[model samples]
Target chain A: MWHELARPEIWVPWLLGMAFGILVGSTPGLTATMAVAILLPVTFHLPAMAGLAVILGVSFTAIFAGDIPATLLRIPGTPASAAATLDAYELQRQGHGAPVLLTNLFCSAIGGLVGVGLLALLAPQLARWALRFSSFEYFWLGVFGLSLSAVLTPGQAWKGMAAAALGVLASTVGWDEVAAVERYTWGRTELFGGLGFIPAMIGLFGLAEVFRSASHRLARRPDARLEIRSASSRALRTVLAHPRLILQSSLLGTLIGALPGAGADVAAWVSYGLAKRLSRRAQQFGQGCWEGVVAPTSANNAAVAGAWIPALVFGIPGDAVTAIVVGAMLMYNIRPGPNLFHENIHQLHLLLAIAFLTQLFLIPAGMIGILGFRLFIRLPHSLVMSAVVVFCVVGAYAIEQKWFHVMVMFGFGLLGLWFDRHQVPVAPFILGMILQPILELNLRQGLIKSDGRFQAAWERPESLVLMILTLAMILGPAMWHVVRRIVAGIARPRTSESSP
Target chain B: MFSAHPARTDETAAPGSNRGARGGVSEPTWKALEWTVVGCAVALTAWLAGGGRSALVLSPGDPGPWLVPWSAAAILAVLAIGSGIAGLVGRRSVGAPREQETPARPAGRWIVVLLSAGYIVVAPVIGFGVATVVFVVSFLKTTSQRWRWWSAVVAAVALTLYVVVLFEKLLQVPLPRGSIGW
Candidate 1:
């Protein structure tokens, strides 16, 4: 594995791909999927190893570079980086920019290595486990993810849920996947397939950030200056201190990523939530806690590696990136699935090497991305904000080359602004939109299969577990409050009688 | 609608918190915004419930397509109304107003919104390259009055060239070239 990486043919395309990934990924709205797709034709004629190198490099490095904007600005470059906007940006606000990013870089590499290692060792078993999930389990899983986002968002739980509900409604705009009918298109051709996620995401995170910066510029609040400098110190000590956290988050990320439809974004959020709940300084989580940065950054990149497990074993794409990758693999006549292990074992080994080496390459690639972003932001704040607005426009337009998407971006930008003012966290809204299809389709399908008897869900053990977890996540706090009140009332009466 | 929660003013809200007086657009009329959202949610719920129930696809066992839409819209309406009512009652209970807190500036914000809207309207007509250059220069001058014209033009042209090379030349992803073309 080590010697294969030493070959110039192997390393050259890989490095070039990493550079491209950093450029595309750090820019809001130009997702990793688009980058890989755009590069697909170029890779068609290249050697198989070289083609794999470009795709794998972009996929891995993009997940890491996404943390750049999420930490430096409140905007996340990709959906996977959304978790970073919570704690990483807060830490950056608190002037811990250098150490926070450095730690993020280191942890991402380690977490990715751990994920690749696990993928190499346990592909078959994990693939089987993930494949066992049915429509019923999928519904419960989506609910659980939604419930987690609601609780994790910093606001009134009801408000978070409201935002999530609004998001789900927004997602219902296109075709009804099961029924083959439109719900909210209102006859616009652009609304047929639905609002694209990338445009809406940039509108919310990118354009919304620009709008805030404009407000701050007018308000004369000079609080939006770049904080990328002041140090270029090592974060090795901090990383060393959190060995257990790095391991745990990586493992958790891998497990979640192995689940079909549960992508890196969900893994990051789940890991961040778990870390906050277990930490001694839980109260300081959203208020500039470093563990918050580490957990999500580590998990997101790890999930990128874990996403390849099902892609390799079952030929089912674990996420969008892998779908494109598996498609590319087919073009190369190196098919995915169980037979590939027997016939193309060497090709599998090549993928393993690329995944492992990609982590090592993240250090240089991430630094360049960070420095480039710093230089960009170091421009005059108001100019930078204006430039970001233009970038958002271009990014939105680039998707399918449609002007309607630009309109969608602008509309969502306004909605994001409105939501921000109302203290509705946009994170849950985005998650809700992403998960709505899975939630709605599976829910109806499960109901249909069970003849509308909801009680039948309890028959499947996995479904029961997931349903229970989802219920607990949504209602646990309120029930806990009721239990505490009952216990207090009983104790108060006993004390009063004893005193008399 | 503009009543204040004197004890817990928007400025006093915790950072990353649900509370606080948000500056900017919502400051003047959050009640209307909240109620508007609630109204929209309510209308959506009614539409989904009424239509889906009457539709033939909703068989005895299957919930059909509108189940999620109705449920989600209903929940949103309920939650938004509750939140709006709480906000209203909190304002009314305060009685006397305290010293007013400064809202986040909306002057530049309005300019940004206008500029963005203008860009969207004009870009397809004028093409991405020309439109981008014009947008950047106008945005810079409007936002930063003291800035030099030459520098702004230089920056605008540079950004245009960069994007043209990126989207058009390198990535081969075309941008809007309008009727006359760039």
Candidate 2:
């Protein structure tokens, strides 16, 4: 893997990825999808590995850097990194920029390493197992993924279910997955195939953020200036002192990463949740807490690495970002799946080596970013925000050269803005959108395999376990809430009497 | 509308007061208006869904694209209903105005909205390149670059060139060419 690092073809992707990563990461509306989309035309001229290198590299770094503005300013750069706001901005206010950026870089690197390691280890086994999966299993897998999303997003569970239902319904547009008969497409040829993911992503994540950003006429709070009073060594020591926290988070990140379709935001939230529950100083979490910073920062980065395993081993993109990577791989005539490792072992090693090296650059790159944040942050929010909106529009249009995609982006952007105002979570919506098609495709296939018997979902132990987990995911939260309410009710009289 | 608890003057302080007292309506009045808007939205969603499946389809399809549209309509209906309910609930609980804080409105809001609307309106007519150049320049002028007229011009020129040169020239992504020539 190390030997492949110096190859010129490797550097082509590396440079391209780094430049695009910085651009997309810096921009609010231009997501990794749009970045890769604009660059997709560029990939036509390059080899598969080199192309994949550029896209995946951008995907990884862009996602990492997306948190910068979110931390420095209140704007969440990417939908996936929005979770950073709860603690990151607070840390910035507390003058923890040096530590926060250092932790982000360190944790991201560690998480990526962990993710790559897991991808190397688990993807082949999962792929082999996936081959045994019928349509029924796929359906269950889809359900399981959605259920986990609902379980993970930090808000009303019903809202998540609502978002997931909407996504499933959206996927049901155009045609039925099995019969290939047109279903909800209306008369539009674009609808004949259903809503494209890139437009939807750009709309939901990009255009929506643009509109929402417009609502906030951001004033230059003099504090928006990037101030790093401490050194990197101090930040490094603080993170190292929390070894247990870091290890737990890295593992959590890897696990979330491995989950098909679950992205870094989800990973961060899950790790944050765990970190809060397990920490001795759990109450301090929203108030410049480093563990709060470490959990999501590490997990999300790791999730990026984790996303690759399924894409490489099973040919199923774990997330939208990796879908681009998978697409690049296919362009090279190098098919994904277990055979990919054996057939193009050198390329796989090269890719792995590149992933490893991106982390090493983090120290220098991140330092430059920290120093530049003041100047970058000072750019008029109106102009930057407008650019973001344009990027989203152009990006959606570029996805398929259709106006409908742009429309979808705007529609979703409005919806996202509304949800933000109402405190309804957006995470589930993203998960639902990502997982719905997989669920629908799998469910129908599974049903066909099982001769329309629902019981077939339980026939396989793995499927059954996944189903149970889904149910548990739903019922556990409800049960806990009910129990808490009941207990509180029971204690009300006693507490009132004692207080009086 | 349930008016069990009348809004006090201070509860009305939220939105209008937050806007520095020039806001047209009292805080309580705005809250009521917000409720009405939410109620109207719900009614609209229900109305949209009232028709048969074909009526639901925004596009049209075999088996009808109404399935998802109807689903979205239903969700939106529910959300609207919930918003109205929450507004009423907020009114009841606080007995005063329930404070719903929005982000401080910057002067840039109107400019941005207008600019964006203009961009969308002009993009197809003038082509992306031309429309984009105007939009970027106007945007920079409206925002932080008052003394730096050249900065706006430079940014607009540079951005257009960068996108055109990169996507069109090198990447060959087929950007919209203006009818007015290069």
Candidate 3:
């Protein structure tokens, strides 16, 4: 593992990946998916490790960088990084120094290292355990993933479930993955498959925001000029002070990332949740607490490193970015999966080394970003919003030649605006839309394979544990409320009856 | 159907619960918005159920696309009920409106809504770039800009390049050129 960390062949590609990640991550509509897709054309020419390194670098950087605009502006750079909106911006608003940004970068780097360490130490065991997840287990896993979102979202669990249902509905709008039956495209040939994730993301998060902004068009302009004043040395020390949080978030991130389809977003959210729960200063979290920045930032970047664990060991692409990298590998005639590790150990080790080194480029790029935030913020909202609108139109058109994507983008923009107006959490909707299909497809196929025995899901302990976690997720908050109510009732004075 | 004070006391400040009831004028608008959301959720749920792989399920059907959305609708329904009951019981407590000291100069809130709605309707027809520039310029003018003509020209040129070069050339995604034949 240490030997893989010292190779020069890895450094070059890693830097390239860092640059790609920061650039894509900085932009609003261009997600990690588009970043990976854009790099695919270029990556095809590189050596195997080099190619995978670039993709991985881009993926991690983009995921972390997505927080840039989300914090600086209210625009989320990527769908997965949306949760950063609440806490990150709040911190920025309160005038926390630039040390927070540097700390986030430092923690991200540390988290990446920790996640990589976990992959190196634990992926083999996890992969072996994962082998037991047959179709039935996978189906349960899918349901559990969707349910987990509901659990994490605040408010009525039923509402979260409803958002999940809406997401599942959104997913079903495209073609059925296995049988190719048209689910709900409404007769357009484009409907033959279903909604593309990229376009939907652009429309929902990007254009929807445009419409929402249009409503308050002439209200007080946002504070675009943000100045951060923290030295790197001081920021680094502050991050070190919170070693426990760093350790916990990194470990949580790796665990979430190692799960086949759960990506950095889930890991980050989970890490944020854990950090909030564990912190003595939890109330200060969304108000720009230092821990708020550290938790999600670390978990997401760590998840990026952890993503490769599943991708490398099991030949399963961890998330959309890894999935694209897998496609690039197939283009080179290199098959991924369990056998690839044995067949391509030297190559895999080289790629791992490159993944580690990508942090070098990420640090400098992140520093530059911290310095540049002020300038970026000064740019007028009209100009920024106009550019965003242009990006949405082009991005929609690029999804396919069809003009219908524009309609889709606009349509979802309205839906997204509606969702925002009501203060419903859009995270579940995105999570459900992204994860439900994977869960459903795997389950339906598993059930078909198993001949209708629902109990088959419990055969795999991993599946069983996840299922239990999902149940706990639903029950935990409700239980808390119930317990709180009971305690309050008990604490009430008996004299209330006499007084009344 | 229980009612509470219109203004919440300090003792009742729970973390995850709604605060004291809003004023009567605002209450109905919020309630209307809540029910509107529920209506959309239910409509979406029905559409999902109608298009399900298996439609023979009970009222508590399979956890398809509809199930989640329908559940959201149910939650909203609960909120709506709570709001309605609050509105009814707090009718007597509905505080009188504060009198304005002078003749009011309207802030043009409806015009803002109309302008946004108009922008959306015009976007596809005029092309995003053109429509966006026009909207921005018109918005600035409506909000009391002195240099409307200059703003319009500058915004148009800048937005066109943004749409053409950045989006079309660099990203290689096409946008509607325009229905006006531009």
The numbered model that scores best in lDDT is: 1
Candidate 3's residue-wise lDDT over B89-164, tens digit each? 5432221112211112224333434555566567768776677677667655564444468865686577676557
lDDT of each candidate versus the true structure:
0.73, 0.63, 0.61
Who is ahead in TM-score, 1 or 3?
A: 1
Lowest-scoring 10 consecutive residues by lDDT in candidate 1 chain B? B1-10
Per-residue lDDT value at B40 in model 1:
70
Per-residue lDDT for A444-484 in model 3, tens only? 55555566455665656776876787677767777988999
Per candidate, chain B TM-score?
A: 0.68, 0.60, 0.55
Instruction: Please list all clashing residue pairs in model 1, or write none if there are none.
Output: B10-B20, B10-B21, B23-B104
Using DockQ as the measure, the top candidate is: 1
> DockQ for model 1?
0.25
Model 2 regions more than 4 Å off: A1-10, A23-48, A66-100, A175-177, A219-232, A235-242, A257-296, A307-353, A454-461, A483-500, B1-101, B106-114, B141-151
Over A1-500, each residue of candidate 2 has an lDDT whose tens digit, in order, gives 66555678767667767666766675654565556654554665566666767776777677777776666654555665676767876877766655676677677777777777777678667766766766555556666666666555555555566566556555555665444456544577877766765566666666655655554444343333333444467668867888787778878887776665577777888888999999898988888788888788778878888878766765655665765556556657877766776677787777777777776665566556655554665566656665666666666666456667767666666666656544455555655555555555555455555565768768888788778877888689769979999999999988999995
Q: CAPRI band of model 2?
A: incorrect
List per-candidate RMSD values in Å: 8.6, 8.2, 9.6
